[model samples]
Target: MATILVDLDGTLLPLDAWNPVFAEICKAIAERAGAPPDEVWRRAREKNLILMRRLDWRAFDWQQLFDAVAEELGAGRAPSVLEVLDKHLPRFRPTDGALEALRELRAMGHRVEIATNGHASYQLPVIRRLGLDEIVDGVRTSDAYRCPKTCPQYFQDADLMVGDNPIFDVYFPKRFGLLAIFYGDWEREAAEHSRRLAISIDAVRPDHVVKNLKELPDAVRRVLALR
Candidate 1:
């Protein structure tokens, strides 16, 4: 039985539209608090990257971070920040090919799971909304494990998981002795960063490199063949 763990944001969904939706949500929140939208966006982006890199997802909730940022901007908002965030959940859209690709992979008898970063309050709805709940056999969100993909322990349970970082992202599955796939799209800046950092997307030498979900089933088969 080959288990395949998949990524959520950029891997299963197209981030081009999602990024702007996120920006719009931040703008809305900033406007409500009478803060500069661009400044709020910049600060939030910086903080999020810092948090992810530091693997601090478990230490803070989105509401706490938002409130702190709001306070920094002289707003001193409260729980309403979370409510405003909830309103924007419907904005996310999975890639046009995601559902079809997932269905095909499932049909091939591979156990598919979602190994992603983010809290359940925010991540679960996105998964359900995208119909991922129907195709994936399980989900492993950072909130569930109290650690992000950047933490090797988080991937320890995945049968197979796709990620950009061979070191941290691919660590769990590899450590567990499961096949790991490196999902790399050179067209995107983040994928380019993964490449430049020599993060071992290929160096850790994933079982395969898939540019998109459409290529995933074949990659799984190739991995199985090697076994």
Candidate 2:
């Protein structure tokens, strides 16, 4: 038996498919802000950068993100994060293969738990909507630890980590002495979200890279075998 921690956003509930929907959201927000969609993203990114700097990548609510776009664009009525999320709750779904992988891992007697940087306010809703609440062992967010998983010290007693972000999920957890299973879309993420790409993963071999979430069971087996 083993203890395992997995990420939420890209690892289990992949956001790649929601890119278009999110773009539509920005457009709607732009209309409300009376600004161009590009400007909306600029302000959002600007605020996001500052927030990341101040908080060092801890869990952040969607309200915070929406507030940034609204305040920076001087639009008080821009669509809120909850409004958009609630509207799309019916469409929310996790990777089917990943869900099965968790169940299989659990069947193998490994404790599968979610260790995410996403806030409970919204992440919990998705967890419930997707019925993930019944799948995994439990969920632990950054708010619970008072720091993001980017800090190597976050996994003081964990055995393993499964996530997408190479830096925060792979390198940091590995630095903390836990094995990391990298779950990400390398080709799709390259030349865009470099953070999700395994650029620095070469430095750490045998980190257990898997392109498909379905391969998680074998990866976990490999890591457990190593121990």
Evaluated with TM-score, which candidate comes out highest? 2
- Regions of model 2 farther than 4 Å from truth: 17-21, 53-55, 185-202
80-154, model 1: which lDDT tens digit per residue?
Answer: 533554665577678756788788888988778877776777667778877799888888877777877666666
Q: What is the Cα-based lDDT of residue 22 in candidate 2?
A: 57
Worst 10 residues of 1 by lDDT: 195-204
Model 1 Cα displacement at 186 (Å)?
A: 5.2
For every model shown, the clashing-pair count is 2, 0
Across 107-173, the per-residue lDDT of candidate 2 in tens digits comes to 9999888888777766788888888889899887876677777665567667899887766676678
Q: Any idea how many clashes model 1 has?
A: 2
lDDT at 60, model 2: 62
